[model samples]
Target: MSTRRYILDTNVLLQDPLAIYAFDENEVVIPAVVLEEVDSKKRNMDEIGRNARYVARLIDELREEGKLHLGVKLTNGGTFRVELNHRSFGKMKEHFLERTNDNRILAVALNMRIEEEEKQSGITVTLVSKDALLRVKADALGIHVEDFLSDRVVQYDRMYTGYKELSSESKQIDELFENKKLLIKDSPISNSYPNQFFILKDEVNPSRSALGMTSKDGNYLESFVSSEEPIWGIRARNVQQRMAFELLTRDDIPLVTLAGKAGTGKTLLSLAAGLYQTEDLQKYKKLLVARPVVPVGKDIGYLPGEKEEKLRPWMQPIFDNLEYLFNTKKPGELEQILAGMGSIQVEALTYIRGRSIPEQFIIIDEAQNLTKHEVKTILTRVGEGSKIVLMGDPKQIDHPYLDEYTNGLTYVTERLKHLSETGHVKLQKGERSGLAQMAADLL
Candidate 1:
């Protein structure tokens, strides 16, 4: 079999610093222009910048083994090389931009493909990138292209919803309600997660149903734990919300992920649950809420104020939910409320790194904007006695290099769904308002 050569895009390496070793027994090539792009972003204060520096260090370390231009042996039995753009600008100007970084990267891939063709070698050269446009351009130029799929957890449509409905004997479901717990093996379900919620319907009577969750031991299916209790002056509006509340309020389950569309009350329910745990129950010492600083549209430049002031816009949605939770009557009163309480901290994901947070209810909003690496960094920062809730809509990702399936929220939910300490719920109905729901559905 002929070994395939993969030409990686800058975003691919920056997305995963260890991407160089992902392809086993295959050749890996990095365009010289990609290194320049990586260098320009090394000073960024976000995860991308951190990954850029890490990739630079990785490549530098690889250079020590041998000359990068000539190629070096990788631990995975692959060869790594930094290839220069050998094709003339005029050759690619017809199909791509004259001198853009993307086009230059394409030129390197094109050069590799042509060289292999001239030698009549049966080897395949494929361009690996996270950028959709780059892949499209490569297709137009007749170059093989693919996404870096190593980091993808699952397909978006097939992502775990954390809830399963099964038809069982009326006696079995009745046993669930009467006994409050049933052995998982007795049911038709084969696999069960630690906190996986279920809707058991009687096969004979479709109307007969019961709501249950996998026991903390992951062996038995049991009823919800105080599912009817109102959380922070808010009641669970639907079945999924009720399930989420059960998972959120449980002290044993330290990790929870909520995925749904906008206005499905993911953020509101998370904040309310955090308040219930931190303020009312005193399960945790404080509440720390954060979201990635990904913009929906073009950036509007820097804001004119201090750090807090600059963050007000990004954190306003959180404050809005807090105000609703506090039921503040006056405008700006939420600020005073938060100040007086002094237990809640709203910050950006950028500064959350390098800090050990213990005994806090950490809620990461818009978590879908994060990569798998970013999600790991955030989850690893949780100290002892801390519970972290990741809330996001898989369809609402704003990261350019991420998709619904590859985002951190989906990654964490799919990867950790089976753990006893982890729970997940995909909210279905939107509870914001009629107009908002209509817009969510129509537009």
Candidate 2:
């Protein structure tokens, strides 16, 4: 195939500035507007802003090797150049080029398509973006548009719910649960994870069975261990969320994994259960909450204030959930409550290495942004009396190299789901506002 030229939208650059490297040695184009957009966001300190700055530095490094407009060779041996040419289309009205940034990005994609159409060398110029509306507009213009499916849900539905049900003979169910490792011969559950949970029932009677899961080797299935205590005032509204809560609170289950889409309440429910168990029940001495420092909406560092003030932006989501759970109508009540407990702690996972934490309830949110090594480092820090809950919507990840299946969250789910002491749940319901749920479903 001739060289494929990929034009990155501003969102793409902001999300994973190094994303240009994913196209192999193909020619990559950064639209001039995308640079302007990224430059504007580079001053911020959140993940997106950090990514923009990183990409800017990367481009600078490349410029030192060659001309920026003439195309510079990347570390991967691929060539990339910035595109500044802009032409109004006959089919598009001037309104399309107004003050909005999304439209300009779309226009650039259309222009690239026009120039590529003249080549006829099988040289494809595709618009890479995360905005659904932009993709729709590009499609209407006969220009190739894609939603940077870089988040990588190969079979979006393949996202599993760490739990399954297997109907077996009543005698088989008893034997499997009673034994340490009841190896089965080609059982259908052979494709499951180590700590995953399963409900084994009689073939004739749906209710006559036991809850179990397969081993890491995909052989035996066993029961699940719920978090230290059943979280009162916290229960799953849906079957998946229920399963998620059950896994999140398990004490025997040292590593609990959760996957879901936005508004599924994965993060909220996990925090609620962690708080209930750690603060109320004293299942663990302290509750340690940490995330991968991946920013979702805008950057945080650019906003003024100290670390605590800077953290409010990142900690806002956590505070939102805390506010809801505590039924606090006033502002700052959640922080005060968490502070009063002295048992609840919120921190970033950046400096957790070499620090052994025992007797703690560790909740890692936005785990999708974590690398395999990073997750392993955090998981290994768990000491006795400590249970760790890792939750994130793999589809909405912020990391660059990590994808849906290959991410650390999925890696742990794949590696530990078979253990009887570990479990996983994928939240599918979005209990948030109707618009949020609709956007999650449609987009």
Candidate 3:
């Protein structure tokens, strides 16, 4: 087999700082321009900045082993090098005239490709980048390119939906309802996961069905008991929502993940469950809601306000759901109510680090924008007694380096699907409104 060389782009390192060690036994090359880009972003306060600083520290540590310009031996038996000589425009000047960092990175890959071919080394040189446009340009330049795939948990279409439809006999459905728990051995379910929901349809008559969830031990199919009344003035309009409600209200499950498109009531359902548990059930001491401050389009830059005021714009979507839940009529009424209650708190995910959150119903909205590392950080902070609900639409990710398959929400859903303490649901229908559903479906 021929040895393969992977030239990583700056965005790849920013997306995953440990990307250099991901390719097993493959020569990893980093263009000097990528280091310059990382240096420029090292001062950022967000995740990207943290990654930039991490990458710098990693390279500095590797520098002690050997000269980076020549090559350094990686722990995985792979060679790592920082190419400093490929500064010429070379072939890229004929195509892209711009002298951008992307182009400079492309130039390094193109030069390597030429050198490999000329030497008849039988080695493959590929550019590993997360930027789609940069990948296209590399392809146009006759250089092989691929997206970083180590972080991806599963394909988007094959992502776990947290539930399954199994054909069962009417007797089994009746047994589940009568006893409130049917042993899986006697049922049609040959395989199951902890906390997995099921819609068991009768093989003879599909209309005869029952809703059940797998026990924590996966030994029995337990009946799903849904709330008969409204929760914080919110009712389950669909089966998925009902499933979400069941998971949200469960005191045994410590982690819940909900994935769906906009208008699917992911945020509203989570908020309603949090409020109900905090205020009505008194199961949790407080209800804390937070979301990443990722902008859809261009950022408005700095805003003039205090901490709470600065976070209002990013947390407005959460407030919108709170308003509906509280049924606040007049302006600023919801704020007053929240202040009077003192149990509900809304904040940004930025300050959630370094704090131990206990006895709280924590709802993380737009969780798809979070990276796996960030999600881990958040989950680790869930002190002794707390439930964290992470809800987001995988398709609507705003993170530049994240896709439906690689986002933190999907990562957790697939990785922890078999765990007893975690529960997940992928809401299929949008209960927001007809227009909202239509737009979510069409747009």
Candidate 4:
């Protein structure tokens, strides 16, 4: 097959410099502006900055072999080049957002398209970018564009859950649980990949069923959450939410992380159970909600404000939920409830450092924004009598380094979902609204 030319955008390099390996050794092109862009971000403190430094080192190592401007042979056997199509900006339109970097990257791809047309052969100068808006603009210019497909979900509604159910005799079920594995028919109960864990409920009593794990190839993946706790919220909106309620309200399940797309109700359901426990059941001394203050693409530094003012952007969703929960109360009534109980705390992840929390129902929103080290720090800070709930949509991460599968939230879910003390449920339905769910689906 003829090689496909992929013009890597700055975001792709900032996301994963090694993304060049995924295209079947196709010819990869990095615009010169993208290199300069990576250089400027090399010193950033976040994941993007780390990726910047990584890409630069990668290019430097390749230069040791041959000229970068001409072409360098990638370890994947693909030829790569740093395109330097420097043309006078005086000929192009400038706008108030002239400082916008995306346009410059798109310009390089556009120039490549022109060069290809001059060669008397049809060359597809496809602009590969993660920025949705950039892809939209490229379409306006009649250029082929695509987003990197590696991190995409299998289906908009699908997620990796480690549980499968079987309809065996009670004796067979007993044998499976005793062995801690099962080979049931490939239903929801048996339809899991390696490392996926599940609790095979009675489907009748749900509480009476045994716990079994599916194998790596669904070869009887083994693990269970027999963590004993009082049942609550049995009538949750979805089966997944009901399962999540069972997980979050348990004390033996010391750590629970829920991950999925936005509007999947990860934050809402966790907070609901936390509130029900801390305020109504009086199981914990406090209910805490906190999240990393990272923005999806940028931080709030450009917007002038004090801590509360600056934090308004990150904490707005938290407040919106609180608003809905306390819908009947007057404005600020929820804040008063928080103060009266001293029970509910909506905090920043930074302030949580070095603190040991006990007897608390803690919800860490946006856990995906946290690095593995940061997540470890938060998790290790848990004292006795604390049930920590970490919730975030890994697919919607703001941190530059991690993706859907690699973020700390997903990392923890993958590693800990098999134990008896931890329970995980990925809510696939977006119950927020029709538009919200549709947007979460298509966009």
Best by TM-score: 3
Q: What TM-score fits each model?
A: 0.92, 0.70, 0.94, 0.63
Per-residue lDDT of model 2, residues 209-237, tens digit only: 67665655676765544532346566566
lDDT of 2 at 210: 70
TM-score of 1: 0.92
Q: For candidate 4, lDDT tens digit of each residue in 320-404?
A: 8777766636866876776777788887776676799988899998888876556878899998899998888777776654566
- Show model 2 residue runs off by greater than 4 Å: 1-3, 74-77, 86-100, 177-181, 224-253, 259-283, 289-341, 345-359, 364-386, 392-422, 427-443
lDDT of candidate 1 over 1-443, digit per residue (tens): 33699999999988888998999989999989999999998987666888899999999999899999989999888999998647566568777666889988888888788888999888899999999988999988889999899878885478899899988888878788889988887545547777888898889989989999887666788886586877778898899999988888888989999989999988888898888888888989999998777652123247797888888888889988888888889987998988999999999887787699999999999998887877888899999999999998888877877788888899999999878889999999989999999999999
Candidate 1: deviation at residue 68, Å?
Answer: 2.2
Q: Tell me how candidate 4 scores on lDDT.
A: 0.71
Summing lDDT over every window of 10 consecutive residues in candidate 1, give the lowest-scoring window.
292-301
- Evaluate model 4: give its TM-score: 0.63
Model 3 alpha-carbon miss at residue 324, Å: 1.3
RMSD in order of candidates? 2.6, 6.1, 2.3, 6.9
* TM value for model 3: 0.94
lDDT of 3 by residue, 126-220 (tens): 99999999998899999999999887889647889989998988888999989999898654563778889899999999988898889887788
lDDT scores of the candidates, listed in order: 0.86, 0.73, 0.88, 0.71
